[model samples]
Target: MTRTAAIIGGGVIGGGWAARFLLNGWDVKICDPDPEAQRKIGEVLANARRSLPGLSDVALPEEGTLSFHADLSEAVAGATWIQESVPERLELKHKVFAQIQAACAPEAVIGSSTSGFKPSELQQGAARPAQIVVAHPFNPVYLLPLVELVTAEQEVAERAAQILTGIGMLPLFLRKEIDAHVADRLLEAVWREALWLVKDGIATTEEIDNAIRYGFGLRWAQMGLFETYRIAGGEAGMKHFMAQFGPALKWPWTKLTDVPDFTDELVDLIAGQSDEQSGAHTIRELERIRDTNLVAILRALKGQGWGAGALLTDHDKRVRAATALAARAVDGVTPGEPILTQARAVPLDWTDYNGHMNEARYLDAFSMATDRFMEFIGCDADYIAAGGSYFTAETHIQYVDEVHAGARIEVKTQMLLGAGKKLQLFHWMYAGERLLATAEHFLLHVSLETRRPSEPGPEVAEGLRLVAEAQADMPYPEGAGRTIRRPG
Candidate 1:
């Protein structure tokens, strides 16, 4: 069945929610009263289009078209899920829900992106409370995977969970309807502590952020608070850690439940502090930095299969490999038969002469094949980063047939010669087994730090020797065996 999502409100959060659904291939309908809503949503979509693909391990799901509606009733008419991200006003929420109820299907779930409002409070006296649930997501919803779900109805909660899980999110069902939900309550605790730190002149805003990010945040990356403390508890465990630190709770340290007075002076001071912390960069630059850091952190977690790892893993499942190389391993293939690399599509930027793939793209495709070949020989990034790099010394190319833009091409690499210090590689590009181009090259191992020719480490050498021995009986391309060329 085709899935569709309706988002009410075109604010930052609404736009983000729309992006999340749209990128996951859900058709989105947004209703907002703001005159500039379309422009604002478009801008958000532009950024999302660029960043979402990078966050995805595979190509994104089919993108959904975004439509705007002036009428709330019109927007939710046929949506599978209705997300209301209106301004956090009780009366406004009530009005929207009343209108939404009239338009949305009885089976479709209605979710509010309300940060602090409980479902009980929002659904007070409504004709149908079970259909309405809190689907509160953090800011920058397109990147963050956490969504707090508050609902009394098991069916509604389960349905919401299914939708959220489908889109690669961690939807935690709150056992009870709390004032601020789980994540926000934790955030409130941190916010209060941050305010106290600034009010007491103990640290600047940046200092507090640095203190958390550099210290505890790094620990939290792999292990949450309880887990970290459990480790600190040593062999004794959580009981010991709690017993040792529990006494600190008795001290006059914090007003955790107390809300700070929203005085003008205090607001000004905090605003000034925020400006001081952020004045150096524009919003776009800040977003770029945030996305880059998120990508790095998520990529790191991909290895550990932690917090954001689930999303990355889900992305990998949906990603279709452009080439067949990833489908199977070349582990024991005899050397004479070409080792098939993955199928690849010509990128939009690689088109040139005669509206076909530029001659250089064939080389690029061969280069990727070389990387896979290196990985097969156990010469991965860590090895290269640790003072070892491969230097291509020679190349011969024959463009037998033209490949146009968007065409899928495959490469088959054959080893001409594999010996200590030098290995000759020959690659052929094919459009479904029809030869399109051929490249023959020679590569030498080099010490990256010294940039000088060097023999690969024994482990790498042994691995290559195994591959070479296996391929020994295979016939090489007629002109495959060639002299190793030296780079100038």
Candidate 2:
């Protein structure tokens, strides 16, 4: 059954939450008072569609239904998960939550995306306070995996964490409530430093951003502050490093003790600098640029299977198992419609200097398609782990046309041969109906224990036979046996 989520606000953060759920195949209903809420959310979704699926080689679930609601109660009705992302005002959130509680399922979770207000404050004068949890997600929530989960109730927190994990998020549950939570507390410290730097003219906004992104930000992406510091400790380890640097806390290198007033002059100075720096790009344009860079970095991490990349990998695996293919899970052998071997948007990072997909990514796409086809043939993860799997013996790719970034592409597989130790397949890559590339993959079944070619299990063999028979009547694909030539 399709799960339902109700989002109480439609701003940047709320829209991000919606994307995380909706793109992951959870039916989402949003309540926001803004007249432009639909348009705003549409813009966010557009960027999300272009970026999120690129993080994984596997295709994401078919997106869930989205609807806008004018009434908060109507939005919360029948929702399995209710998230309140109204403005940061405590009174406003309490009012919204009251209406949400009146209509929500008794066991449904109520989450507040209030970065500033603690849960204790939000639950004041509210109905269902015990169910209200602080579920703060960062901006661009669909791409970033970290979620700060804070609630007084243990079971509530655990259940919330599980739901977040299902959607490919890493929820950090705080043992107790604190204003601003953990990440924000640390971020607030650095944010104060950056503000002071700009106020003092020590650095411009762009320069300060460059300092972090070009330096420790990369380290911090994989390792949090303390772990990075531990590595800095080198041969001595964290204790020695802390002992050596502990005294630096008193150096007053930061303006954390007091924040600069948001006076007219200071505001003008910051605004002027920002305008001179990045005013040319619209918010939507900047979002795409930010999302593109984020997708590239996350994909790189996914390759390492560490940090955010691991989150993405988990997301992709669940994505395959949750939606379209869920009914045909490995345990059940019933064949359904030919599963989509690949359905993805060309990420901006995949483009070369010439602004088309790099020559190599075409093969990458084909290889992932081959993975999906393997899953369909019943020789997937489980079969491989049991000591038998197919190995790619040779690959031939023919690029017929250019594929650009943001293009939605799909791949269709044709079984050339699937019997005994030989498993040959062909995939045609398409940007909509236009075929842009064709790839032929020849594979050999191998026994991992013996390190030699071997016949697959009967189940796998039967599965392959079905696919081969299904496509046997189809005409042979063009460019099957063709090789490169000076003149043809």
Candidate 3:
């Protein structure tokens, strides 16, 4: 089904939520009091268009339409999910919740994107408060994988977790509702110690940050603090480390529990040090730097299969292909029509052993492009998820030319055969006017759950027939009878 999400508040975080959902192919309706909400969200969406595509190796699910509504009630009326990203004030949340409850369906999940507030506190004075859950996603919500889901009602939390998981986010369930959830609580502890270090002249702001990031941060990236320290114990593990360091807990070395006085001197000193370290960059420049670093770090962690590694694996899994021959998945083609995808330069990660784009990635890229073609013909998630999909059964690939790394290429797909149980497709990969590769594929419609040959659903079959009918008059490939090229 094409899910619909209503995003209330069109600021950075809210815009991020909209992009995440919309890029994942959910229809989005945004409502905010500010008249400039559309402009602000547009800017965010532009940046997201570039960033979100690269985050996943797979071609993104077809993006859903975006709508801006001035009326909050209208926005929530038909939305399946209501993501409240209003300002973090309790009163503001309560106010929005009241309106959302009045307008939204009772079964719809109401997600509050609050970083520090408990769901219980946010749900106060609500008519059907049990529907609300804290789905606190990290900053740059479109890119970050972690979303802390907390709710006193386990059902609500579970539902939210399932929904977020479907869209490719790691939802960590909180055992109990705390002020800042799990991630932020760890961050708060570090922040408190950082302030004390700065105040006591033990370390400057930048120095303490560097000490943590350059040292433990590297370990924390792959394995968390406890797990990393457990390895440090040399087979004794966490228990041994705790026993050895337990006595150090008595030292008055940390003012962790105590709050730092935010005096002007302290603020100025911290600000000056931060400025010296990194504040020279403009916000846009800083964002670009952050995105680049995130990409590189996540790429390095891909082998770890922990944290970002799992995420990268999931993203890559979405992009699939057959052995040596590039597999092409086709849908929505009238029996004789064609579908096309304009290619771009291969990203840095797609290159391989020869420093040129890898053979496997050509198939990967073609598969992604084919998915977008399916989406164009209405063979989207709901269509495939409902027990019907076109699986490639046979393929022949001819590499006519080589495309170097970073070279822009394009693909054109034509429907060659359409029968009751099988379909044949031909894809031509081109670099400008030169044909670089030609892929001939035979696909079978199958039940996703059963893994057995099956007829397409009524809607999918009808769309396929329409596309096939248009291409019925076209000629087959010239090399149709040649031996299939085995994958290298």
TM-score for each of the candidates = 0.57, 0.57, 0.55
List the lowest-lDDT window of 10 residues for candidate 2.
328-337
The global Cα lDDT (0 to 1) of model 1 is 0.79
Clashes of each: 6, 0, 12
Model 3, residue 206: what's the lDDT?
A: 69
**By the lDDT metric, which is better: model 2 or model 3?**
2
Question: Model 3: per-residue lDDT, tens digit, 1-488?
Answer: 88999999999999999989999999999999898999999988998898889878789899999999988898998898899999888998998999999999998999989999998899889999799989998878888888988877877777888889988899998889989988998898888888877887898976876676545675566546654544444444444555566556566777763545555565456445544554455445544544445555666667667654576677665653322112223423334545665456666667666877678877876776566555554567888866677787787777777778568788877766655556666788888898888777777778889999887666666656676776768776666536644222
TM-score of 2: 0.57
Clashing pairs in 2: none
Q: What is the C-alpha lDDT of each candidate?
A: 0.79, 0.81, 0.75
The residue-by-residue lDDT of candidate 2 on 360-468, one tens digit each, is 9999999989988888778778989999988998898988999899999988787778778988887899998899999888888999999899999987888877776
Strongest candidate by lDDT: 2
Q: Clashing residue pairs in candidate 1, if any?
A: 323-342, 323-343, 324-343, 325-342, 335-471, 336-474
Residue 402 lDDT (model 2): 98
Where is model 2 more than 4 Å wrong at Cα? Answer: 257-482, 486-488
- Compared with the true structure, what per-residue lDDT tens digits does model 1 show for residues 308-406? 556576776466344344433334555457677646667555677578888887888888888878766768778877888689988888879988866
Better by TM-score, candidate 3 or 1: 1
